[model samples]
Target: MLTVAHSVPKTPEHEETIHKAQYNVARAYFMGFGAPSSEDDGRRWLDRAAADGTRRGSVKAQTMLAMLFARRDTLDLEKSFHWHSEATGNGSLESQGALGVMYLYGLGVRRDLVAARLCLTQAARRGNIYATGQLALFYYRFRFYQHAVRFGTHLARFEAADVAELARQSECLPGYVRRGLATGCYVLSRCQLLGQGGLAADGERGRLLGGRAAELDAATADRLQRLFVNGPWSCASYPDLGVEV
Candidate 1:
């Protein structure tokens, strides 16, 4: 039965029709027939479909191509930045986040903290969790500076409220809640320890919160601890500073 069906003579017209049907099926698969389990397979079909001028395939291909380039550590940062920027401009949130980080670290462009903050702000507004964490950290550092300028003056009620809101936003971020929690704990600890911004001295509570921050991520905890131990706070500029609990 199978051989008989296979032997059915196909006219030139029928052959053309079959070819068109196959192409249509291929197009469907390219769009995500089973969503291709392997990256190589997905890329292969996406490339074919993109070459055939399918818009969705082209967009997917471009996004994946940018990702592949960005993942290569040895790739030129400028090229990677360009690819990511293009993808981001096309409305890829992941690309937007990647570009934001590159800008934040000055990987390809001149270091511009303001620009980095702007990019991250855009990503965060789009619901990127990492961007949210970055924003939270930025605000936390800003509050610290504000507190320092006042020479341990109590934080204005509004400033305190802002800190709390930033912290809350950070914690609510989907993928970065732990990091946000750790950051929040660190900021709270600093506020308590230095008696800055009109906060009462609470060495015990500060130590506990600091320890909790470290518990969330050992590396972050260690870094913060080192900053506490060796930073200018221990010097004459800021006296009586120690990390001991």
Candidate 2:
């Protein structure tokens, strides 16, 4: 009997389809979307999808694994950072933003503000709303109020969807968009109220912005108020503000 050795499809289209299917399978297992929900199985499939190819893994899979490892009950910050780094090298905007956050918070490595700023700036310039919001917060913390205002204003004026519509269909919006919008409004309100960030004192506008922040995401709004408004702000002591990309 002749032995047969199986090889991965050489066609790029075929390889792409296989990788996508692997991701879909992982998602289905994770979410119970036409499949039984099983985190173990989901993780297994995700690993396959993320580490299968001769080239770097699938960006989506790498990013998702990073998020999963960072957030799951059994957290693994090192694994998360590794995958995010890998995906960032692949030019994934989401991973770039995530890497920035990890660096800012010292999640899996030594905290490095310069590295965080570099990663956040690259992602923010490429339209990563999460990165933009984080950059605003970073600048604000460092007293670079002008830069904070610039980034915050961009998020505050996100007009892709009407506020009322977004409120009515919050679930339809990406987590990053909602969180970014809320963070922007909250930051701007603080700026206006305190006359920082190159903004004049405007309690009325600040109040309105505060209200808008609540509308976009009450939980995020509450978190920001508790961490930055009602108490002394400390980035090291701040709670997680991760965007679910």
Name the candidate that leads on lDDT. Answer: 2
lDDT of 1 by residue, 22-120 (tens): 333344454655444355554454344333322223333444445455454434556566656665665656556556666655665666778777886
lDDT of each: 0.49, 0.75
Residue pairs clashing, model 2? none
Which portions of model 1 miss their true places by more than 4 Å?
A: 1-75, 140-177, 224-245
lDDT for position 90 in model 2: 76
TM-score, model 1 to reference: 0.49
lDDT of 1 at 220: 52
All predictions: root-mean-square deviation over Cα? Answer: 12.9, 5.1
Give the Å shift of residue 237 in candidate 1.
24
